[model samples]
Target: MPMPQEYQLASQHYESFLTAAREALHLTTRNQTYTCVQATLLVFRHRLTAEQILMFADTLPAVLRAIFTSGWSIDDFKPEFGDEGDWKAEVKAVRVDHNFSNDETPARVAAVLRQHVDLPRFEKVLQQIGPDALRFWGFEASARI
Candidate 1:
């Protein structure tokens, strides 16, 4: 079979995602957006089992899939989903000087991400993973964005 479009246009797709994320976060540079996005991905990743993470990653675009799973360790302790403040703090902790993630970061990133994925499959995976997963990604159980 021919190479997948995601693989063929990997750089283009990643740039598009970074552009959208930068705009959504109102960030001045792609580097700031990258730090925030990576940190946010890790915050969510810490709550999922390996199997669930794989299921979710399968729905992402090529570059995003790599970002979501990079440097993951299944042996790490999975933290419980806590308050939004703590989550935001965690997002800001990565490359602390560069990360500019705020309380709305996850929601903004989620909005941008929805535009790049198979929404139905993405939502299905979120639903299967349970309510906390849905909320972590700034999605509501019955709401479609």
Candidate 2:
């Protein structure tokens, strides 16, 4: 059967997000494996001059959480020893809490992440992350293609 029009449009949006993220991944980073997390956090950290962190903070975490819920092992990307917590852990905690493994922790962490991001900054990051990634992750970008 043909894919639904909504799914097709979402795939397009996801493609755009992948492109933006892929571009961001290439810019510069100390770690290659954590490139996506780095890019996402760079977006979250207000480090990107063009992007706002708050606007897309919620969506970013949602995308990450969905990925983990789908059975991806975040532990595959270990944080450097002495690093307090990174995006990978943060994303995992959200998924675990959502899945009832832990409840209160994700909320607190989400709040902290929110504080670090602002809507305007996040909007810019969203542009970086692309509407496609969001839609691909199941966040609504448009009602129709």
Candidate 3:
């Protein structure tokens, strides 16, 4: 089925945000992760459009199932834009570096996001994504970077 333009565009924007989050949260040795941001974005997008919510809602289960059962690599998930795609699989694509500290991840992410994207825009994306998507991604973040 053909996806609506709004849904496509929103998805694209969300991907952009994901890239930004990854860049913002980069660590030296520990991998940079964005499951939190991704989950929040999915929830935010859901708030903006019913179709987007439905579409993402449908796809997420399968992706998680694949992650759970098949042991697919998170790095295999292609980025839509120019992101370097240097991430690790933790139920979702999370960036990790062998040198980064555990506690620095979230703060680094927040800082990078502030540098690249504004607060309102960030919150807007999170607000639109649905609860289920948030919960799904949240599961991945059970062990936060």
Top-scoring candidate (TM-score): 1
Shift in Å, residue 20, candidate 1: 0.9
- Report how far off residue 17 is in candidate 1 (Å): 1.2
* Cα lDDT tens digits for candidate 2, 1-145: 9976544565454344444443433423223313343333332242222222333434444444233234323333322311223433443443242222112222333333333334445444445665543332233445422
TM per prediction:
0.91, 0.27, 0.28
Q: What TM-score, to 2 decimals, does candidate 1 have?
A: 0.91
Task: Please report how far candidate 2 places residue 142 from its true position, in Å.
Answer: 31
Task: Tell how far residue 93 is off in model 2, in angstroms.
Answer: 15
lDDT of candidate 1 over 1-145, digit per residue (tens): 9998879998999999999999999999988899888988888888889889899999999999999999999874366777678778788777887778887888888889888888889888999988878877768756742
In model 2, what lDDT does residue 86 have?
40
Between candidates 1 and 3, the one scoring higher on TM-score is: 1
For model 1, what is the alpha-carbon lDDT of residue 61?
Answer: 91
Query: Model 3 over residues 53-136: C-alpha lDDT tens digits?
Result: 444434432332122224233333322312112111231323333223234343444444444334444333434453432323
Better of 1 and 3 by lDDT: 1
Estimate the Cα RMSD of every predicted model relative to the unseen true structure: 2.1, 15.2, 12.6
Q: Which stretches of candidate 1 lie over 4 Å from their true place?
A: 142-145
